[model samples]
Target: MRALIRFLFLLAVVAALVLAGAYYFAGRAAGPQIEIHRPTRLLGRTGTLDVSIQAPGGRFNDVTVALTQQGRTVPILQLLNPDAGGAPPDPRTKLTQETGDRIRVTHPLDRQTLPGLREGAAVITVTAGRPVLFGLRTTASSADRRVEVRLTPPKVSILSTHHYINHGGSEMVVYRVDPPGAESGVRVGQLQYPGYPATGAGVQADPTVKVAFFALLYDQDLNTPIELFARDEAGNQSRASFDYRVFPKAFRKSRIDVDTRFMERVIPEIADHTPELSVSTASADELLKAYLVVNGDLRRKNAAFIREQARTTVPEILWAGAFAQLGNSQVESGFADYRTYYFDGREIDRQVHLGFDLAVTANVPIVAANAGRVVFADYLGIYGNSVIIDHGMGVQSLYGHLSSIGVKPQQNVANGREIGKSGMTGLAGGDHLHFTMLVDGQMVSPVEWWDPHWIEDRVLRKLREARSRPS
Candidate 1:
């Protein structure tokens, strides 16, 4: 009996050692690990889910993703069998993959498809299981996410009238927004021009009312809808159209002849300063091609750079009344002139002259069109020695081809202040000043801003009404 008892004790000790070795190698105590990556808060009606799993020393046997609401289980996806489990229709958005013992899946959620998203509180559960080496399969789950979705859009309305805008001119609109947090703006084409808090200068200072100066680009389609748009954080959008009249004007066209002397002088001057063209050492033919490329390709890049500077502006009104032009200067060219360039009796290129060219001899004083801060004062590609002034609220003026700049960037200059001197620095045939009026960086006819009568009837009259109205 003593020998038998000793033999049983030895057998029990051997069994305990084998079990400990198997568990240590397989990591059965930890079980499968699951990690869920989700946003801390969901302000929008739609969101997404990105899940990652780490199964050590085991292969994933079952994986399920589901949305639970009102005791209803809507299965989002399952990865049971590679052949039996079909993927979402769009693999880029919803996908499941496994590499070794790890698995990952990403899915996008929309309120329209996922009805549970409309519920006030919905739970998203992810459960995963793995098969271990010792038949110690374990399951892990995470149901910690309870989402809140909003779907109501904000309201916007126009308060002021006489919304007449010329084809290549600027106009101001006064509007009101219900929720101050919503982003309200003017939507024209793909671009949205945001509105600002109204000032007591033009429109009465109201917390809800917003003032926005918008432009109708010369090349914009007449049938395009220009409406006030508002959107909330929940992805809800709203639009309201105001009564307005657009007067379309036919722009003047001109043909410019590019001769040997014109090419010889402009090319050498440009090539000497601009090495980006790589045409300083080229022949006459190559120089002409380079000029065409500069006029076409480089022109767009210069305009884009100028437009990007309009993003930051003072909210207050910096200037009032009609803008002042360069005194004793004659208008040499008009705005929006469709020009055709001819070289050696053949048409080489075509471009639109956006601003007016004022001639006042060589190196004449150029004054600030209105009171504003200088945004940019440097050499540009086509408009060399350029200076741009911001007159607040998306209204700005640009002076190009200057002989010398007098003001630095961010310097405040009043109306009629000398900012620079004009010269034939850029792509020009003679000494002239390129003056342009930009509304939100879109080139508009400066003739409107130069006429005092137009300002009183269209712009100042609207301001007078706003001032007289009970605040």
Candidate 2:
């Protein structure tokens, strides 16, 4: 009985030894275990944030990284073929092939990252594992890592001290940027006043980052305040305020007198020819409205004609400033009745001269300031022998009190081309040309358009700069 028991005990000991050896060999073949060297961490916002993972002993097929913000998992990185599963000498779980080794991953936080993800603190978790038993098994979990993201937006500041104010049209507001960066991504908020036109925002390297804003003033009320706002990529914001005070402007009445000889002659001839003579006395305001209506009608009628003719020729009309006549002139009292006529007279009595008198010798050649089509070259109510030209884009020029009309309706004329001769027509006092400019039906100061330098610096320059800016 004792011998038999010893044999059985010896057999049991051999079996135990074999099992222990097998377990040892299996663990060795599996290779060294891999652990996350550093837990995934959050980085501040508004800039690049780099995260890295380290695998010790290189015993992982791949590394899985996840970012969590406010308990929500964020997809930071995705690994392909993360687990290497193969037959095992000592079970698949225990034995890892040479293919399954160290695994490392990296995640970068950029502008494209989730919005709230960059706002506050976030958690990063990294897991290292390999394929075992036809499934992925985590070998080690990284320690919890936390990161803070900050929101930093761009900044905007106006370089000028005071806001620019003008009569009523397009205006540019220039601003300077502190740190030059990506300007295309910036957004500008609307102004307080709704009447202001859309603003043209852009950046420049030479003069400075400029935002050319266009605003309109319908009413002449002063002390109007306008607000502007800007925001950057990181959610940063800036604001500015400007006020415009509409001051009273003085109205200057031209002291020069108009000679009525030309008008006197034309009216009698027109009466003799046409049985019905249309005679109307128009004030400055009424005359402007009439000019617009007539000009528009003429443009519509001669659209094709103007386009075909002016396409090849430059404008011939030239704009001259208000001038006074050196020779003797006579003025009629009023439109009511030809009661009194004054020669070389300066009277603040009977009739008030509303416009500046342009004195030119009779039969002197008159030209256009720009290329355009003649819309009207007939007798106007009180304008007498008049010619109106359409210059496109809601701009029109008028020449009244002409001795003779050279260009007929629908005729194209080039700049500096003779359209008529200076004469005292309509309700004029002398033989001189009357020139006027209208914008969108409203009469603007002709003096401004006459200055080429002003147009280049203010109008053309802004347009060129706006076109060059990136959309």
Candidate 3:
């Protein structure tokens, strides 16, 4: 009986040892991990692949990457048999060794790199192999990503001609874009003015036709090239140029003398309205300092805020005929007036006043310049009680320095409708209405837009011709 018991105990110990050995081998057989960082969905004409690989023992035997489409596979990268001193098979594949167990690989996936590539569904596969069990066995891991290859650019064409834009003024263009829903716009140097469907402008001619309102600000050069561009979701872009003329004008420069009472009135009010600015309106010196901050920093912030608000404009023409100016008001300041500010016999700062300052009777009722929706009706930094109306197609009008606002945001109003009452609010010296025309968030001269003949010739003529012509 004792001999038989010893035999059974030995058999049990052998079985435990075999189980431990199998577990150890199975753990060692696990492969390396892979991570792909870019081109998560669509691969364009010039796309890149970023991949990372990690191995358990700080070393990988081989790594290979290939793209498969329509049942065909094309190798893009290969790091083969590093222990055998084998280099990468493709010269364009960039390989980096982060550590013994980790590596990074990047390669271009463009058509020039992969000549066999076509616009269709594709799969990117990355496989990594690491040696285990004393180099006798190879453990492997793979990662695959599905993406669409897009090679064709969107088609853009100009449908209107005889475009004339005044320096520091606004203009409109009508164009057509294939793939109707693609993002199409007018690109002027570094600035982009978005396009709206022509149907939005009440034109029932073509669904693909688009209209855009653009501007040449007081700062941009007259010769700055402007072109219409169409870009698809896959980052493919196409641009076309149309004939346009630019007329330059001389801007007037003036000096603004700052006084103690003006600072005392304006600084404290702006500071009270704007909690974002940290300033003590107690002393004259501090008031002057705060005034500078409001003029320079707060002014820039307000401009940026207006630009952001412009993004919410409806993609249609809400205004008909020319925009209107304040009734019986005299222009106290013209658009783009280069003003040099002075305090205590010394120049403090210089800034360009982009809007017209019109003055009538104190606390006079302010009216909307055109038919549109009110985007903002509140106390805006320097503008005080202000109202911004979206005239659509990226064109808007501003009625600033109001004592009271009568309209609410998103409320539609007709031309010459009362929006507020003018007062000495914001940075104003006296009761006035600061009026301007905004083209795609850019402040432009409202003179042209206020003229009946200019509106008919520059804007309405193009829309009429586009609707009358065959698509």
For model 3 the local lDDT of residue 96 reads 80
Root mean square deviation (Cα) for candidate 1: 5.1
Better structure of 1 and 2 per TM-score: 1
Q: Could you give me the TM-score of model 2 versus the true structure?
A: 0.36
| Winner of 1 and 3 under TM-score | 3
Put down candidate 2 lDDT per residue, 42-129, tens digits, no spaces.
Answer: 2444333233333443435544456787778875554444333433221211222333333333334554544456477876665544
TM-score of each: 0.81, 0.36, 0.85
Question: Which 10 successive residues of model 1 have the least lDDT summed?
Answer: 81-90
> Sorted on lDDT, highest at the top, how do the candidates line up?
3, 1, 2
Per-residue lDDT tens digits for candidate 3, residues 1-471, read: 999999999999999898779657855676989999867998877788899898864577888888999999998777886445466677777778777777788888787767788899999999989887666667889999999999898899998878998999988899999888779989998999999999898778767899999998899998898999998877778999999999998899999999889999998898899998999978888888998999899999999998888887999899999889898999989999999999998999999998999999999989988899999999998998899999998899988899999999999999989998999889999999999899988899999999999999988999998989886
Which candidate do you rate higher for TM-score, 2 or 3?
Answer: 3
What TM-score would candidate 1 get against the native?
0.81
lDDT of 1 by residue, 1-471 (tens): 999999999999999999778766655455456766763445355656777766664356666777776677777666662223455444544545565556566776666446655535567777777665545644444445665656566889887788888887777877888686688878877767777777635565567778787878888877668999988765567899999888998888899998767767776666666667666426777778878877888788788888888786777679888998888998989889999999878898999999999998899899998899999998887787889999988889999999899999999999989998898886888899998998777788898899998778767776677667686
